[model samples]
Target: MNKGVVKMDFSEEKILETALKVVKSNIAGAKVCKPVLASFAGRKGQKALTIEIRLDSVKLKYRVEIKAAVTKSDKMLLAMTNKETGLPVMLMTQYVNPEMAEELKQIGLEFIDSAGNMFINQPPVFVFIKGNKLKEPVRCAIKRAFKKAGLKLIFALLTTPGLENTTYREIAVAAGVSLGSIDYIMAELKEMGYLRRRVDNSLYLEQKDDLVRRWVMAYPEQLRPKLTLGTFRGPEKWWLHGRLPSQDTMWSGEVAAHKMTDYLHPETVTIYCRPQKLNGLLLSNRLSRDPVGNIEILEKFWNNDEKSASGELVHPLLVYADLIASGDPRNAEAAEKIYEQHILQLVR
Candidate 1:
């Protein structure tokens, strides 16, 4: 009923058509052609809708993927889609949330939403517009497997060897989740094709690369926020020589990446510890409470403290997630290094 908003029952074709209209209206003299299904070779006969955009004497083509909504987890898939295709990808969606929009730009993927939010960087025609309000909320049913508690279960399964093949009671204990949460999460994962059952009634994880990518994307938003204890200020580079008060506390985020790869000088420090260990960690590092502090302390979500080779550092997965979630371009290289050196083996 609002003037700028209209209700939408989303379908891929409808979303593409609506987004095209928004692009045409916002960019003067721009022409958008009808989308046509086209197949790419060497991609196992993968097909995507192809569309051409024309502005004056210039024409650009893209393999377009139309969706009802785009979220943070889709970034890796979109980037991989572009890498696999001959042409760049231009996502046509009903809406592009601000965080997702920023992530898309960071990865150099172009998109146009029904609200006219877009980022297309081609020669002589560069248009980057964000912050457009969505015409309507996208209705999506998120599975329990991707929620916060489920993230812990997935983390345990991914990091701990043979954890998925164990009993549900054991898994629930290891993941620090309710027994009920495990049942639905496991079922949803099976339905989502992330878990495959064996003839022996055992389960194994498949598509673990994608699973980890999704986890990394979702952790900062879903789980990490729930784990924050507090923030505190410390002496500049205090972590350079400071010791953790107990083995229960470990370094994570920028500092962990620095220690793991030695490729980055951390600008901030992140610590994960049991809630009771927080005070000792602060005292050991000479940190004081500050609302906008350079150091952040979060409740350690995992039961296992032996995830890393060093007792003082968190697992590379958590470090990678923290860096990527920061949305800092400077941390991107370091994150990539950690992924290639540490994460690839676990997922592969």
Candidate 2:
């Protein structure tokens, strides 16, 4: 079919007239509904037009929305009419943000430039995990495998035209993961009945019936806060904070440990610090360099300093003490002695 070029004189009525002409000219036995002007801007420095066209016939009923932005040149307006309807196009350097490109994709618009060098139909997958109180180690393993394999999986699915049948090796190479890992993950998923492999080795991920239920049950209720210790402007400064699901619940040391594990495990680091006690006083004393004297110092402020009878403090000095206690069995004994002589003396 010869593509029709419809031009309007930059008015609402003219725009609708042009769209109707295009529909009548190109589609056989199709009727054009009244065009809705989605957006129209013609003022100083910006000029654009966007319209939605609806077509209905015995065989097909579909809607096409078109947006054309113009500057000094009319190239973008012309390009909008000529470009293929639903294929992704690589945008030029002039495009402002990645989101404009994504918006085009969401609307099923393909936007290639003159050179045909770009495509942007990157499919996204939603992962659903099941079970409650799963181990941290297990979650880490699953996330790592997914990151390594996700891009390849999406690419393979996009390039492969039909769903007739394919092999595991084909999917593995396309997903860029070791065959062994792919096989292992697939086996685990299948045993859980979250996936199925056909006789032809085609693998499919099944959407679970109770996916949201599993998510609600598996979500963690508490998380640990983090402590940042650094030298700001040549003076030692320490700050501690953590985000909780809500403010009503006080932070817990065990929850903090789990949060630390979640954040640091990918980097292969460990948290060696303990929760701080008598944090505010310790900050003052560490600055003063005065002997805390004995357990009395801590005992005096224990009720005032504690978040509650049950809440734990994640202090910098406590972390340092924990590290010292960890390195040498004798240092643990020394820490107790130091606490009794200095920190406890102040509180008492």
Best by TM-score: 1
Candidate 2 lDDT, tens digit per residue, 1-348?
111112222332332344345345544454645433222221111112233223332322122222222121122222232242232222221121345444444443333221111122333311111122211111112222123343224223322323213566656664445666665655544554445566777765332211111111111111011122221121222113322222222332222222333221111111212224334433533422233321111111111122223333322223213323223222333333333343332222
C-alpha local distance difference test of each model: 0.78, 0.29
RMSD (Cα, Å) for all candidates, in order, is 7.1, 25.5
Off by over 4 Å in 2: 1-145, 154-164, 197-203, 208-348
lDDT value for model 2: 0.29
lDDT of 1 at 309: 73
Best by lDDT: 1
Tens-place lDDT digits, model 1, residues 1-348 = 221111222365567777788878999999998876666541434344589899999998998766555554456546655776788889887778788888888889999998879999888889989898976755544456768889999988888878888889989988889988898999877765678877888888876765786687667667888999998998888999988987778899899998888889998888888999888888777899999988888888877444687778887888888887676667877877887788878876
Reference-based TM-score of each model: 0.76, 0.18
Error of 2 at 44 (Å): 46
Q: Give me candidate 1's TM-score against the actual structure.
A: 0.76
Clashing pairs in 1: none
Candidate 1, residue 62: the lDDT equals 91
